[model samples]
Target: MADLNTQHMIDEIRDNIQTGDTLKTKLVLAHLPDVDMKTQNRLIYELSRGDVRFTVPILLYLMTEHVSIVDELPVIKETLLSNLLAYPELLIEFLSDTSIKDKTHLINVAGELRFEEAVPALLYLVANSQDEPEIKLIIETLGLIGDPQAINTLTDYLYAANRDLIITAIQALGQVGTQSAMHRLAERMGTDNEMDYMILSIFADVQDPVSLEKLNDTLASHYAHMRIYAKQELVRIGAKAVPALIDNLLQDDPDFVIHTLNVLGDIGDESAIMPIRKLLGKDPKSANVRFAAYEALALLPLRKGAYTLTAGLTDPEDHVCVAAAKAIDQNYSEILTAGIKNLLRPKGDEARHIAKIIVSAQVDKIFLSLAAEDFFQELSLVYLPHAHKDTKEHYTRLLVKHGFDEFANKIQGGEDVKNLVKVVAVDDSRMILNIYKATLHELGFEPVLFEFPASAIEWLQNEKPAMVLTDLNMPEITGVMMAAEIRKKYSPKELPIIMVTTQNETNDNEAAYAAGVNKVIQKPFNAKSLKAAMDEFM
Candidate 1:
């Protein structure tokens, strides 16, 4: 029986059915090897057949590691679904763990179990933090759960105080794609300002007559973005949008005329040819208007206006010349080759750069590929190290794709300082606290954890860490106070102190500096910035 307590409590729970000692059950479970595969499988069966209070820790461990419990599907449906209906605290704990990666699986489970009770927590997740990406997918799952109660919460966020969140909510609503969602989006199209692009995108999927009229009217709006959005949407709608675009082309509004012409080209409707042909003579001076007309003429399948495009190559306006060049490049490849050859021949340094841009914009597929490589190489040189870590991957990929394979190799090998660096994050949020732990694991650091100032002081007395990365608003004692204590305890020449916090607590920064913290990294930290901050300490 000694092995009973030594074995994981999940195992003990399965074994100790006779004793019924619940505290021993929990205490034993918390210490057990959290990820033991056989123990986990047996625990799933136990949870399915009977109620257990220790389900939170099991769910958390599985969620953090992204473990898919496909074998435990029946148990998940039985226990988690029942608990979710009876006790929302379990759902709250599960949803709040940001490290969870079986988000899609959990979402599917939520729907299958019909956990309508989780709607409030799901909405809270969507409305609250910027940390989780699963919220968007979860919102769609909530709708799939088919709980009508989530409608009001989703609608409220769709018209949020935060514009970015409003966009996210709108996108989620589109995924939900209910009749009420369409109606709400259609109303938003008529009333929302500077959202013409979003509205038109939603309208293409929606078959609302009112939304169509609002989009058509927006073509004549003063905003150029609106005109562009309307044209794109009309083109996406194709034949249904032809009459409205044709009607707008007849109007005298310059934005209306220009956008209508662009839509006709994108739609490639042969019916637009006669109206487009007539527009060329009306405004020969306005190059924007003329370019739009020429672009549409070139889109015609019959290619009747080939001479008009060719004749415009001699126009004095550079933009008109470029437009004509682009139009001709569509039908005739030799013209593009000859045009590029002429531009590059004996051109000065200024001409070479312009030729680079022009060639990048060319219709020849091979030269376009070369131009893209050059453009991205130039961009990498410009934004290297300054861009976010997410962008650095693309910038490095571009370098690798080009002939700069050695340069890409150097970049990949350059960030090896992570082994020499260390990070110490102190936060009350268990998820963020765990994130700090996992980041250290990934970066190959020996991390130390402390929930209170006493624990931090105890660690400082014994060990000499490379650097300290602490959160500001910790309980019992603030991180700044801990920094002062560290400064008092440690030598001035020892490791640097770097404070991390979500709250600006302006006074905290000023005070932390006063207490001799070497640096401070704010929350919502990108991995690159965090790495660079640690590199300084190293």
Candidate 2:
């Protein structure tokens, strides 16, 4: 207590804290550790009550340049963070001070505070810093700050070869959560599944109309799992997704329309019914879309015009006709039955066509809906005996199961597909598989269909059919993926694979051919196109 040098230094530090002089304060803080604990604590308390601006920088200086001072006063660093956050302008000044080299701790403070004012300094650090962890911290701080200015820099990091940087930048952009930030995220899709899925989830969280549109656009992505993930998110978005999805129908892209229809159907929003009906009325050229529409209609409740569904019974494509029959059975109408009755009265091609529709639609609801009609039942009996055994047995059992034992007994069992050359086809959509069944049979080949790629691959191990037709966008193992597996056991010369897809992009075509496909054909395929492609390998 009587030491002159130490007592004089403590007096100088006290005067510096009271005077709010930065240079004088740093000079005095340099001697702070030399004082006793009681004197240091008293000086720090005075420093805390000093000018806020002077207190922050003086504390930063002591912490950065005087490690012993910080060790002697442990609360000094936490106090520095507290003051910097409490007065963000001071945080910005401290952050912008490049002369104080180690700013990782301060950059974290800026991020944690989401200090928007600190963005410029953070950006400066981002541009100047070579340290990855520090740069990552700056990127995160900018995102947390959510200034529009940071988007360009954040997007630049998206292209970085470092996966961690790319991932961190993606997350930061997600935190920014602006329309521009989400747009930047969307642009990074298709680099890979993990990133694509990450972007999708971000869009889901943001859930703006723009994000919804971007999510809708992913339906057209060449990758199947991405498309699947997009659909799941859209479905999860529910009725809120209806307007944009309805707009998707107006676009000429039928593949996009088909996916939108699938999501809309899963959502089952009643408002979507009219838009869907309007799409159907436009007579979309894609049978896949038509099948999807009727499939959706089967799930939706019909309010007024259930009778209009009977028109599908006469659609030239068996797939469309069958889907219509399923929709009709779900919303059973005497009016629809009568409309179908009038169509069947000629009891010739139309009568036989309705019978085939009921049998192939395969639900007992549609079958029983028309079973009481003499002409229809009699006509179905004629074709039921000759229909594919699976179709026949399916109807027979469902008929018996639903208490239509009499009609079940009347369907003479089974048509032998054994005589036809077996052609393997894989598509996730049951509607598409049914189309393959009828189309392949007409070409004098038996169709063995798989609704999953895994099952198709497992079957390909033991059973190599004449040729395989697989949809390009099946879940998990895409058409290209399945083609690669099949190529392992069988050469293109040994077995031809045709990639059936709604989207005919050059990248997908190139990838499919690289995976050992014999041909890549676009969908809404007909007997003519299907046969033309099939005959090449035959």
Per residue, candidate 1 scores C-alpha lDDT tens digits across 1-538 of 3345324555567654435655554454443344455665565567444443445434434444433453333444455556555765566566656655354455556665667767766776656645445655666566566565666666776676667656766665665556666566656654464564676676677646655666777666543335446666777788787776777776776546766776788788888877776676564555556656766665666355544454445444434444554666565554544544444444454334433323222323323333334443343333234322333455467656766676555434324233444445565444344445535544667556666666777787787777777766554556777888889877535968888754344555687888888887765443456678887757
RMSD, one per candidate, in order: 21.8, 5.3
Which runs in model 1 stand beyond 4 Å of their true positions?
Answer: 1-24, 34-37, 51-108, 111-152, 162-164, 178-200, 204-217, 250-254, 273-298, 301-538
lDDT string for model 2 (128-181, tens) is 888998888788788788888888999999999889899999998988888988
* Cand. 1 Cα-lDDT: 0.57
- Candidate 2 local Cα displacement, residue 224, angstroms: 5.6
What's the distance in Å from true for residue 262, model 1? Answer: 2.1
Which residues of candidate 2, in runs, are more than 4 Å off? 1-88, 158-166, 185-197, 220-229, 401-406, 413-423, 437-448, 458-466, 525-532, 535-538
